[model samples]
Target: MRTDLLILAGFVAVGGYLFSQVWLSPGDRILAHSYNDHYQFEWFLAVDTYNITHLHNPFFTDLQNASVGVNLMGNASVLGLALPLLPITLLFGPSVSFLLAVTLGFALTAFGWYWVLHRHLCAHRIAAVLGGGFAAFAPTIVSHGNAHLNLVSMFLVPWIVRFALRLFRTTRPVRDSVILGLLIAYQALIGEEILLMTAMALGMFVIVYAFPLLPDLRTMVRPFLTGIAVAVGVSLPLLAYPLWMQFAGPRHYDSLGGLAYVTNDLNTLFEYSTTSVGNLGGTLTSTNYAEENGYFGWALLILGAGLALWLWRDRLVRTVAVLGAIGLAFSLGPDVGWYFERTGVPGPWKLFVELPILDSMNVGRFTFLTVVALGVMLAVATDRIIKASADGGVKRAGVPLRLVWAAALAAALVPLVPLPLPATGRPPVPHFFTSGAYKQYIAENHTVVPVPALKATGDMTALTWQMATGMDFRMPEGYFMGPLGPDNIATNEPPPGPVTSVLLDVAKTGKAVQLTSAQQADMLAELRKWQADAVVVYRVEALPQLRETLDPLLGSGRQVDDVWLWDVRALTRE
Candidate 1:
């Protein structure tokens, strides 16, 4: 085989091996967050259930329960960018569904990246291999891919870069724009948020480059409009669920309860110290430089910089200049970085704010733009370098380009060789949380029961099957009457009514109720109106209202079975 082909094959092999060693272990279920496990796993489980009961896969509707909230169906964004694996869940089950999705996502991303580089830059097979290979192993991709379908959508980025190149190089605007439109549609299928961000970046680049082509606006508009129509057509199915939810659902936007729950204060941005680098595979560090910074062809950035410098005398260079500036600004957090905090506002940050879609840009993660900029820089750089090489061989050069390449090769090998040594056992993830009660609960109850789960400790999977053991857990269904709390959202239900409101009509309300300030009076009154059989409160304090309110209704039979299984039947009329 040719050297480039061999190198490309090797890259694929390494990506596959790394995925198996790092991500596919039996116990590698929990992502960094518990919600990831619950949401993604539940989605997969729902797919399985839909196939079994409805005899079809509901790839378009991820909401499982429309009455409570909205959940978008995840499509493997890298491949043909479709929910191609939904039906697979029926054949294999949830675990296998996850495995297949990741594996297929990685493979599709790698292949698509290679095609983009080859088509756009006319890069040698080795360059294409390196580009795709490095992307497959990007630390952010690997780490976040544990549970995030959105991050994996990065596979489409290379294709976007490809379309950007087509717009620049040829007179085939009609063909190129149509292709670009298809890419947008595919990206939307994988992740609407990512698709939005990428489109914004591409649009800015196009407008900047369109000056020279302005005379032919008539020809350009046709393709541009056609591309827009095609993109909209492809995204209809994926958008249907979120659209419905935004108009009628609990949380219209992403949940903001975790680490990202930042205060409006600008100081909070700089105050957070977890930024630099933490426990990066056990290497403590003050600085965040890679063993090989700007590897995988940073030549592009240098080349682009040089182009802008040489063309400093011209307006076309302004395109590269503007993009470079935007990318750099984005890299600096709008509210945190010293540069952005003070100066970002009156400029690009204002642009981001005015555009609602850009809200998902998430200030600190300018890394996306940086990576895309790097690709552009490299493409421009490679074009220049090829021209230079054509004119004069490296041996006749003023600069030691060969030496630079050698140094880069050496740097890349140093860290990889010792790190993934076969002698060293595979990386370990601690199983800090286990559930004996959950396992016992499942083994004991094959039938669905209507009992609240015990205290709710660890992974939701361990808790989910436990909770669903007695009762058939269906979405959009409410059993207990109360205002919906955060805990209720996880189970796909709204909170019960306030305890006070549920007891307002009851003459024996004082005895049966244990009132708390948090419990709404209307809720208790409503519960009383239902003539409920029982009320179960996990927290002891929540029980006081119920106990006081039920005391008179119970009469001689003060039947309080337990917190998890309070016999509310006594509260109802005998």
Candidate 2:
């Protein structure tokens, strides 16, 4: 086998090894986040089913965040992602397809960077392989793998960089630019936020790399700008309508309450997540499971710092080091802090607080660049060691520098390696929903109301139920993003009314809520406004209380299989 293909196969093995549990037991329900991934996978299933059956707008679905519904264009619809996997999802289910996608995501991301390094950036195959490993399997990316699939699908970032460098390095800059544009369009379909972040990093790379060759840059400027324009033009067809719908469509909302809490402390860079195979794991500092990206491990960061100092004159090293510094600073997100103390000082992120799209972005995710930068630096250091050892003119006390750097890299990797992700139990869905029995309760134009509306902390049973029924009927208060109060931040779950909120609490906590006469009247009014076709409550903890509470508003309900069903069409019409 060719060396590049051999390295790619090795990466595939690594990815497979990491996610073996997911593939081996596909039936066992799993989620990276307690709620998000469960809904995300089910959402993919719902959209796939929609695409298979109907010739309609897949983006405008009343199935989730029902009534007004959600504008998927404004949300992480991931439509393009789910489309190609229609066969796999239809046959084995979304869980199996999701696992496969994730495994491939890792492998492809690693290989993309390896291609760039070996073919473009570095000459040493070993250094390129190591760089690919870091770029693809960093602790930061793994931390996001807990729930964020979009972030994990980052194969295009390196590919974009590879082609972007071609704008400067090759004679065929126009061809590279057109391909670069297509890659950007495809990547946006995968994860626009990551693409945006990648763009920022590359923009920094261009400025730093161009400064030294000022006269050469003037000569090169035409092709590079033309390449960018061509890329944007190429992407317009794929992105134009979606972007138009996102900003202008109904049920869309602005971003709010973002990044304030998830920002990294200065010390977080030095600390490692409990998942890392580092000495300081779980000891130095901590953040939310998804936000545990600040760590680059002490060994790697220290070595990268030493390398930056040694190679200050080298444009690539300086660019990477500066990029890492920028990412770290930006990820601080308005606040400056040490390990335990908040200095209350402002960070560079404060400048971006009011900046349109930047406001919504999770500034903490910028730590991704720091991890990438460190990996590239590690590869460079390895290459330098190899060259020094080969030349024999540069040696340390009769010892080969190659052996010294090799040992150091091994030491760094030992602490930076991450533990595999684990799976968890999914709540049971009733045969009534899964076996298409729901068709009896809800008709073509009607919406089913699941009592105790879907919320993140509680079970989002209705979403799975809808998916199981092949989305035969729409449901109110489902897990999706739609417009919300005051500032209009896009909320994940629909805003439940007073009655729904009370019942949701009962369902989740087994705690009863006392209802007053006025409250009872208000709940009834809200239910009528929904014009609900049917109501079903299934697999709940406080069924008796829910039954007693709702009996006053809408007579007794009949039990069918595992669910209690109430036909509310007559009353809702009245």
Candidate 3:
């Protein structure tokens, strides 16, 4: 019937198909099992639960880091996302809520693109659909949908771009300025990196677009300035504290490290993956299965090149091309590589590496705009075909030019269509955490020191434990961003402190290591230092040898509800 309804139905059907595993899973099976999902999203849910219980202040929390705690904004401060999803978490549990947000993020993000292309840029609804679909199902989007909620939840990005353009054209500057401001402020909370990418993309667009209209630039300057003022005014209230906290907070740090490994290679961008069509044997050069953003496939690249060539004079096409080039350049990272081969010729990214705010960002994420630019190019190409035929002048090989372009577009998109995002079965959380047996030993302000305390590796499922129990108790080690140790690196992998690190390494190796009296004394002192009430060992393959090794040093632990726990409160009392 209507274009909006058609777009809506398409978004739901395709987005649902991609995330079918999550939506169709039986009862609590929709749990996030990815590395970041299990650790990061799980902990955020616990933080959200705590925030709701204690008014709306979400800056710091005791769930992670315990005493020093974690500054929420310094990390992935998803309060904008978490607050809205709170009802779902309360009703269906945190895992379900996480899956829901992820699944819906795809559809909403695509719809945002559709709205921009259909309402602002393209002449044909079908053209808009092509752009939106490609944007939503881009290999990179599905790659991230596996875990990273903030990256996937880019529904606001296109709108931000759309309104920034609206400022140049709108007579009602005040209204559009307010809209742009709200979008920026909300995006700052959800995807600050995405906002930066969007700004970069828009800047590239305006630089080229304004050149052609250089004489008219002064006419557009007032509205543009008004939009910026309104955006900063509206966003400053919420963003002010978090920006300061990230830079000046007690636990803030300068470096997060591992900058080179996350770089994108030119060959990797041309490569396909398990998610995309044309092949199932696609491989990745990025660290793991989760962070693969390189694939744009052969089909889109060819078709996009043709469109850019055909519409070379078009402002939007030129702007998209410039933005994509910038993304590719930035994605090369500080140490440039050619398809996994390090060339030793440093890229432009090295300049930004030493800069304050830019250094903290993952260099790999710049490719996000390349995907956005490609989607817009596809829409522009489709519209050109529609126009040539509607004018009754363009024909190719006795066929209407529109039909030819349409067939080519279909050919490109069909072979490159991506599969659903893959899902994995979650490991069971312990009954000690789930059954609430921990309540007896641990209380408010007291901590549960999970044995091994290896948060990213799933060995420290204590974050899940806190989320399961609605965060009734705090835990020492967890998956969160914080400045830690003497050098003060702000990272997800904070040291497990002295005590947990020694025990954890030995447990992982299953080695018989003699603990000296001094070592035993240090462990006990660390317990007191942490203000811990208890320590828990969740059922794992390494538990048996770990227990044998730790019993003599930490004293007898009680086994209850599928967990062995040491009540260290009495021993740690000063």
Candidate 4:
């Protein structure tokens, strides 16, 4: 069969399995919040393309305007996975784009596993498949299915390693630098925190491999410098939006000391029991090894032991040792007491500026190193084992003899160990949109709400900060959860479109404001003072006020879209 067909078949089989095991029931799931952000990002990407191509601006400026890019959520405008989503949507339409992205992602991950192992072991196909299989369906991948594009982006690892090794050997600066640079840039564009972690790991790998090429610094220097250049060049496009936000964005933690506690999130540590033997599912949560099964599957442990044995007699032991050490450190960092102290409370390495980069990565996801390292080790060990066994005078069985033995085994065990068939299921219903009021409007209109231009009046409250920041949306720069009020809004600004609602926290009360009849009138008066579109009642108590104010506004303006209208004049004219 052609490789394309084989690859397609593999993707279909794996995708079918994942959909059945996770999406079909309550048996395997997490809260919607766990994955909603990432999935929503996918939607943002599709919407953003329409925004950028037509509007020329990246923000959703007006609530009433539905043009793409004009009034985008600034936090969401950074084009994280937006580029990847473009081609998939164009090729397969929006409905299948997400599934295609996952398919391609997992396929690349599997291929990466294959490439890493193939380099270590000559041509051991079985071992390569098994290692890739383990990685593609690893627990961390499943746990982070909804929110983590960078974590799932591990599919790029194998290609990076292979290219780096090739560069190390050939000393081709331009080629090596270009590939490495592109990969790093891609990482940065995805998200800054993950990009920083990946850079650290790659740097460590280079240092380890550098020792071997030390005799000729000329080769090493050129490639390294070129790689940096390439990385900078590829990342240039992203410079306009994200880099400045690294320092300027609202930071919850001020010091490295705070990161230790904030990133640890204790609940994650005890979610799974360690006792589930041979389980590798604890990557998301640091559950006990004995209760939730071990995060390192038995196969991984076996490979690690073999790798250790190989190191004692092997010339390339340094490579394995370096990779293993990095992997082990990340794996044990959360469990051990020393790592906890070192990462916090003024440890030696904490002084470096790059330490902030590492800290920002949050310690839990150090598992990428472990998975890649294991793939390499599994490949080498499995190859050695299979070769040694096969070449040791084990006679190849005759065709007839093999057939007879297989028939006898099938004949004997047919009833006891029956082969299970694949389960059938319906297509997935998009829970993300279906439950919301916006879903109905989107379904009826068949297009996402167009964001208004900056020059136009618009509402900014609908957007979350993450979305707003990405788009570079320049409206009332408020956060979904924040300490400050909407003080970012300009004093003489025009009405910010038809008011859907307003969130007012009165008197710093822990309890939210419930707008009463008097409050509703007062709120509308306030909006009118700001040259507002409509008055918003944020709470249930404010509902009556909202109804009173909105009923008049609705009468004056024609309903342009579901949320709000352009204006009462436009409605009267229509």
Query: Which candidate has the highest TM-score of all?
Result: 3
**Candidate 2 pairs with clashing backbones:** 32-146
- Model 2: per-residue Cα lDDT over 1-574, one tens digit each: 4877888889988888767656667656675443466466556655755855587675567676556777876666666667777787788767677777777788999998888877777548888888888888887787777777778888888889888767765688668878998998888777878889998888888888788888888777667777888888888887887777777777777774542356788877876675567734355364666667677767777888888999888888898999988998999878787875788999999998788888778888888998788878877877777766776666567666776776777777787787766566666777787777777777764677786576765666567676666666776676666777887777775667766777766776776666788887786676666557778887666778777767766778888888888777777778
Model 3 lDDT tens row, 1-574: 4869877877878877877776676233433436656457756865876788678557777667777678887776577787888888777777777766776788888888988898887558888888887887787777787677888889998899888888888988888888888899889878777888787677777777788887888887767877878877887885788778777875776677543247777666777755767557765566666677767767677777777888889887887877876787888888888867888989889988878667767877788878888888888877777866887788998888877886887777665677776665555778777787778888776888886575666454556677778777777767777776577776676676767777677676876456788878888887886788888877556676666667787778778778888887788776
Model 3 Cα displacement at 116 (Å)? 1.4
Per candidate, the number of residue pairs that clash is: 58, 1, 0, 48
Model 2 segments more than 4 A misplaced: 32-35, 259-261, 279-285, 339-341, 390-395, 508-531
- Two-way TM-score contest, 2 vs 4, winner: 2
Alpha carbon deviation, residue 52, candidate 3 (Å): 2.5
Comparing candidate 1 with candidate 3, which one achieves the higher lDDT? Answer: 3
Model 4 agreement with the true structure over 1-574: per-residue lDDT tens digits: 3653575468546644543333344212322422133334444564555455556434333222222112233233335455667676555433244444544666677766765665454547766765665566544344444344445555666665565555545556676767776775565555554456556676777777566667886767665556676656755664645444433433212223332322222232322222222222324344211111114543344446556676545534456556655544553333343313333333222334255345433454555555555555555555655665554543337434334433532332221111111122222222323334333222222222222212212322233221322322222222111112243321212333323233323212224344467656653443333333221122134334333444553353223223332232222223
lDDT of 4 at 10: 81
TM-score list, all predictions: 0.60, 0.92, 0.93, 0.61
- The lDDT per prediction is 0.41, 0.75, 0.75, 0.42
Candidate with the larger lDDT of 1 and 2:
2
Q: Write the per-residue lDDT of candidate 1 for residues 13-109, one digit (tens) a residue.
A: 5444534543444233433322333234434444444434554423333222222323333221222222455465445544445555555555566
Off by over 4 Å in 1: 1-18, 21-24, 32-82, 134-143, 160-183, 212-222, 229-324, 331-333, 338-347, 379-393, 396-400, 408-459, 462-472, 475-574
Lowest lDDT 10-mer window, candidate 3?
A: 25-34
